[model samples]
Target: MPYYMFQWKYKNEAVKALVQTPQDRAAELRKVVQAFGGRLHEFFFAFGDYDGVSIVEFPNNERCAACATTLTGAGANDLFRTTVLLTGDEAKAALAMANATNPDYAPPTGYTHHS
Candidate 1:
């Protein structure tokens, strides 16, 4: 499964709704994620440009996107962005295989040939 970081900012109307009732949105969001084959690992309400940040895990990017769409439809604010996250082990594996020293490989522009 892949992890994703979701950031959302509330529209004025959405803010009004939350201001009227500030509790349980995090819990509600977890339910939404679960419904879409994703799991909400962490959620935080912020005091900055974005209203909240959530870390979610899904079997694939499609499922992650579905979760985001569902949140939007459930009256979350607009302009949502999702960033895919690689676990430490996944990153390490990629790093190890990045350049396996294939003699026939040609480096892309500005990249130095590996010795």
Candidate 2:
């Protein structure tokens, strides 16, 4: 299973709803992830570009995308946006593969490599 970090920012409407009626959102989101054959490792509210973030593990990218699409499709678009995250190891492997390929390319106009 691959892990993902899901981040979101609440809309004014959602903030108003929460202020009027606080709810156990973690439990709610856990159920959604479980339904998609995924596990919700953690969920937290934060202060920054995003209002909340969640760490989850799914079988594959398709399953992860399905979860995002379903949530966003079901009225979340007005409430928040989601992002998929990758692990450091995965990123390192990708970099290694890119280096192994030794791709040949020239820089844009007015730029030159000095090596």
TM-score of each: 0.81, 0.80
lDDT winner among the candidates? 1
Whole-model Cα lDDT of every candidate shown, in order: 0.85, 0.82
Model 2 misplaced regions, further than 4 Å:
76-79, 109-115
Please provide, for model 2 over 15-72, each residue's C-alpha lDDT reduced to its tens digit, 9 standing for 90 to 100: 7888899999899889889989999999999998878889999998888888878777
Candidate 2 differs from the real structure by a C-alpha RMSD in angstroms, to one decimal, of: 2.9
With candidate 1 superimposed using the best TM-score fit, by how many Å does residue 35's alpha carbon deviate from the native? 0.7
- Clash pairs for candidate 1: none
Task: Name the weakest run of 10 consecutive residues (lDDT summed) in model 1.
Answer: 98-107
RMSD per model, one decimal: 3.9, 2.9
Error of 1 at 14 (Å): 1.0
**How far out, in Å, is residue 84 in model 1?**
0.4
* Per-candidate clash tally: 0, 0
